[model samples]
Target: MSEVLLLLLLLLALGPGASALPKPSGQRQTGPQRNKLLLVSFDGFRWDYDQDVETPELDMISVRGVKAKYITPPMLTMTSPSHFTTITGRWVEDHEVVHNMMFDQKTNLKVPHKETLRRTEWWDTGATPLWITAQNQGLKVGSFHFPGGGAHYSGQPIQRHVFETPGFPDDNETEWRENLDTVLDWFSVEDFDLVTLYFGEPDNVGHQRGPDTPERKDIVRQIDRALGHLRRGIDARNLTHNLNVIVTSDHGMTTVKKRPLVDEIILNKYLPLLKLASFEILDYGGFGILTPRPGREAEVLESLAKVPNITAYSKSQMPYSFHLGRSQRLPPVVIQADLGFNLNSRLIVYVNKGDHGYHSGEMDMKTIFRAFGPDFRQNVVSQPFDSVHIYPLMCRLLQLQPAPHNGSEEVTRALLVQETDGASRLVSSLLLLVSFLFFFV
Candidate 1:
């Protein structure tokens, strides 16, 4: 009877079954940690998206979970790099996923944004993402339509990954449900410990219809509906108790002024028009990377300095505050247009009504962050923070040893419940003492 009782106490101390068992002292797990985690990102969800829409689901979670006023993404706030930064806990410079597209300086060749995601050379440069890290530390993780989800890091595959279509699409409500179901199945049936799910939304609509337009509002409603379904799905699958959920975004959207309405930063308009043969221009909405041909650095700088409403810099000279200049993949010259403007090669027709890729300090570039579940505190709303801090938060959640990252575990400590092991450990120790007495004394 004493032995059976001691076994019961041991099981209780270790958590439901043995999945939450702590590793060695170096990788000591903390808190009454949850059994699993699910990270969801709705592309281009601005910090204030909940204000205008009836986001009952998001609002509900804020009260039941933890909410951040906002979180700043890294510089050149686009999709892939920012998402990678969230997972790796590194700034754009450290992770080296500087932009959406991949480019080779030697050949001046470019890969489309979608193709760039699948290319291993760009993603596996150095940092190991959460999927790789968690799996390396003995956890099963899945990625569903997330940026860098499909690529192999150092030739190692994600335990599970899904990205059926290219280009973040919108008219796929049914598919969204199917994907959520699949993830829930992974957690319940396949015993996955962590999964990252992504949805391309308001970001796509915002680009075509502008951030403040009615079409954008409709997309926001769609996002709320999706959130509602996820909430219900969690409860239905009995995962609300053990599954921690964090919903966030890559970056926010801002309106872009077209040529007729406002002056576009046309590179040719600047004096000493950068010769086509002497440079490689990668212009994406408000951000542009200019790779000057050898010996043409002086000419490129002079021409870019002449352009009004544009902040231009060489890779070595990029503003230190932005934390964006360290990547070897970055080009010779970089330019950022002032808000409400875009960098265009030529004053052409058809501009995206909305765009990101702005400097990190732009309020419009900030993103959303929401988290909840067993391990998180209730009804705590936090001040704005950088997204890089999220990776450390996740590492603590899983009790896994995090790879070298720039974020602080303390910065996100406020969001979690205080660790409570004193009573449990004491009772467990007493039980062991009694068992020893019964066995030998």
Candidate 2:
């Protein structure tokens, strides 16, 4: 009788029907089951933009989940490269998306962001994106206007994606709502595990008027209201408990006060030296790449180094911290403009009042990152982390095995609740069943 009583007590302690047992010291407890994840990106949303704008929806999310003070984007903080890095968890060098407009010397191909949708070679190289990884693991994935959404990877595109229309302005409010509604519709579909939504707002307006201008603030408020609508829709459908939502930006914007023509400095001033170069690609305002003539590499580097407000580096001498020199698409000589300066051609007449693609170390180039859902701790504020860390967090929330990538678990693990072991739970269930049989017999 004593043995039977002991068995009953043990079953009560270990049974699956019992509440979760206390975890051993130093063992982290896992979060609740989070089967759905939604990632949203606001283009060029600066880290501090929220402070000046009234973002009730974002505030609610931060109060409910976790918000990073700031997130440092990868070097060459351009839209396409930063977005790809955020999804792939690798630096631009490793991912091979060196810039927004990439020129490949071997194929003599110039692939721009819009054209990249159909060009597999541009995005399919290096690490696979989160969407592809999730889809391969049997989770249905969908994207609405997210970068890298249209690429056909592993012989398949995202299950449902809205491709950007060529030359169509993406800053319209109506278009933004339509895209958000489409993503919400996707969530209602059967077994949709992951969905990505993008909005090109404040960035478009920021560029036209300047990051600190009143016009930019108004646009930010407009975007905030739109997000509120999205939140209400999710709540209406009772998905707030099941979906993990993350809101971030590709990069942040900085004011561009001067536009320096690259030709005046590189071509005209150093014409004799530049003529020796085989190709010169000065696509973005912040960075320039020069593919020198076979033997004139030293000459090109020397001449460009003399240009003011521009720092030039030979491929081998590029900073290790930037992690930019490894890709074949990189030129022999790379040039970066100092903060607040735009490097352009003499033929170009107009420049946006605001721009990005500056060095990542600039605070103005930092962006926002906030997440709210069952998988995250409520009311938590974390220190600034690199945007690359987000990839691992996404994998964890979706309960998928992360592919081998540059992201570190140590960087993002603290933000997540340690999960309990399923095996332990199974053993508890078996013990309870045996105890029940003995008692009944």
Candidate 3:
């Protein structure tokens, strides 16, 4: 009987059904940890939600879950790599997506592909996305308009959709509306173990008009309505008991106060003009950090730094405390703008309404994350966290092992079961006991 009791105790302690069993150390799982996850990312959300425009729908979701005021992004605040980091749990440099545009080192050419629809080498991602991982574990997965996830999961038993429009920034609203319709249709058809919805309008509008602008607010409202539809879908299917909804953005967008230094004419004249080795955006400016190819650093900086409205930085002189990567592909100098400055390329020179290829420090690069589901706690988390942590949090929700991510487990505290054993160390640097002591004491 004692042996049987010991076996039962082990089952209760480690098994998913062990909630009611007391730990030998006299503890229990924390509040509620999610079981299934639905992550929604709204591009170009500011980190400072308090200072940004009002978002009633977002606030409601936050009140029902945790809301982080700051979610630091990877080195390059571009959309493609940032989203890649979010799902793969790695930095952009580690994932091999240094920027929005992927260039071939040998040919010295750009590989062009549409945002979500492109499946070329330029768009190839290194980390396994949550959809693929979930499906591997027999969970049903679905995503609407999340970049990097484009149709990769399509025809694989998981329902994945993509929307791509040529020269889209000019007609973002129309495309977003059409994508919303598609998402609504998917929600209407079948029950999903997981679902993701992404909206690029806010990011697109914010890039052109700034995050707090009137147009940005309008975009937020439209996304809010779409989320409302999602909530109603939850009710229609009575999924509140099992479904977990997570909302977040890749990175925040900011407004450039100053003008661009490398205008179209200058860029066109200099691109093929310079018999240079390589060029890269180190941080957030033309001059802030520029790494020229080997012997070309001095000449490249001398030429590009001379431009007004640009700041240059040596590879060793970056401002913020971020460990980008240690690789041969890393540039020797990074360039950024002074406050309110942006870089102009051939794409932006002629357009009246323009938004492309910006890595500005002032571009309100903050993103948002809020979650509500069976596995979430009813509390507001206003601390700073990174979006890369979401990948592991989703894995925990589905009760599966996740690929390693760079973020600390403290970022995922809100996603844990109340009074549980502890967060897996691989997921966080925090000592669970220390966190508990700090919170309680």
Candidate 4:
């Protein structure tokens, strides 16, 4: 199919559940501007888990700055897409990273002559991330291994560095500190305005060891310690005196109780009205995407409405808060198998541990967000915040213009220091002086 027609097909598949942009609120109000900012992405962290344990680094940040109690991400709640939203202020449709694995259109013989990996440009389609933006604005940008950071950032002049290796290790803390040292080393020679670091142990360990497992608990503590080390590193450089720090995550995790197995024939028996576009036979059950053939969408929708152990949604029916759009990468009819039903397979497998990609009821779906710096206040606002909002807020804090994909509402004023009449008076005096000087000249 032609590229235009293919994109249209994808948009139709996204259905009506795609999210729309929200109205602008004056949440990006300026504060006493800061000289630098640091963002640390703690992948796959939950808002509430192992509650008995204390997050001292985060708690310290709260005491010094502000903490939003919760930060929710868009549906599918995966890493790449959420990270895209968090940094670019766009949704899955705009970013074009609908899922972890890009579609292999060449696999279908119908497109036998089609080019491979051509349409699978997940990293290329989105708006420039914060690092790219900062670099373009003549500010130094440094990044550790984020999901999409390794991809070409439209040839932007941002510094990309890998401080940590993938997969979990016993000495994750050591790796984290080493990465901190690398960031510090770079900062020592360069005056970077924005820095991004990512710690992957928590997410990896949680997925393998389960959130309730002792191994996962230890990993969380280690992550907290790493954050402490990070703070010390910043303190060592004296950067904190005028810098802003943000801690956040991409998505949360969920637990699986029993893997539900479904026969392809049995599933097809009930899904006659729907045309299955993609199918994966997973350990717990199956993961699949469906669409209506030709004009049969209404029948498929009605059939999905009657299905149990499944949550089916049209593209338009998706939560508006996510801000997704009708794009070709999406399926018009989406199906989320019942919680705990793992689609088991050798190549595509879940570790039978606590993981994500289930329902909203999963605690692992709740992520984290905490910011501290000269521009923020010491308020503990417990209102739930969206992960997508962090990108826009970061730009606002750095006093940089936002990218075209920024669909998020700016953070509320409660997160920042209160404006004062004294500053206003100073501004008035400066304006009056400039006006007088202009007239005299």
TM-score pick, better of 3 and 4 = 4
Candidate closest to the true structure, highest lDDT: 1
Q: What C-alpha lDDT values do all the predictions have? A: 0.82, 0.76, 0.57, 0.62
Per-residue lDDT, model 3, residue 183, is 56
Worst 10 residues of 2 by lDDT: 20-29
Model with the higher TM-score, candidate 1 or 4? 1
Q: Stretches of candidate 1 above 4 Å error?
A: 1-34, 259-261, 271-277, 347-350, 419-441
TM-score winner between candidates 2 and 4: 2
Candidate 4: residue 98 Cα off by (Å): 0.8
lDDT for 266 (candidate 3): 37
lDDT of 3 by residue, 1-441 (tens): 445544554454455642422222212223334344567777766666434556676777777766666676766666777877887777665665665655555455554435424654444444566677666766566777676666353334235555555565633555655565555455446545567777675666766666556777777777776677677766765667766777777766555443444332233334332365354332222222233466776776667656665555665655544445443444565555544454543334332233323443334555667788756766667576666777766666666556556755556855544424333331232343345446766
**Stretches > 4 Å off in candidate 2:** 1-32, 106-108, 259-267, 270-274, 345-350, 417-441
- What tens-digit string does per-residue lDDT give for candidate 4 at 205-319? 7677777777777877787788788788778887776677888888777665543344221344455532533332223332344555656666777776675566666766766
lDDT of 3 at 342: 48
For candidate 1, write residues 41-100 as lDDT tens digits. Answer: 999998887798787888899999999999999886999999999999998889999888
Better of 1 and 4 by lDDT: 1
What TM-score should be assigned to candidate 1?
A: 0.87
Q: Model 4 has how many clashing residue pairs? A: 25
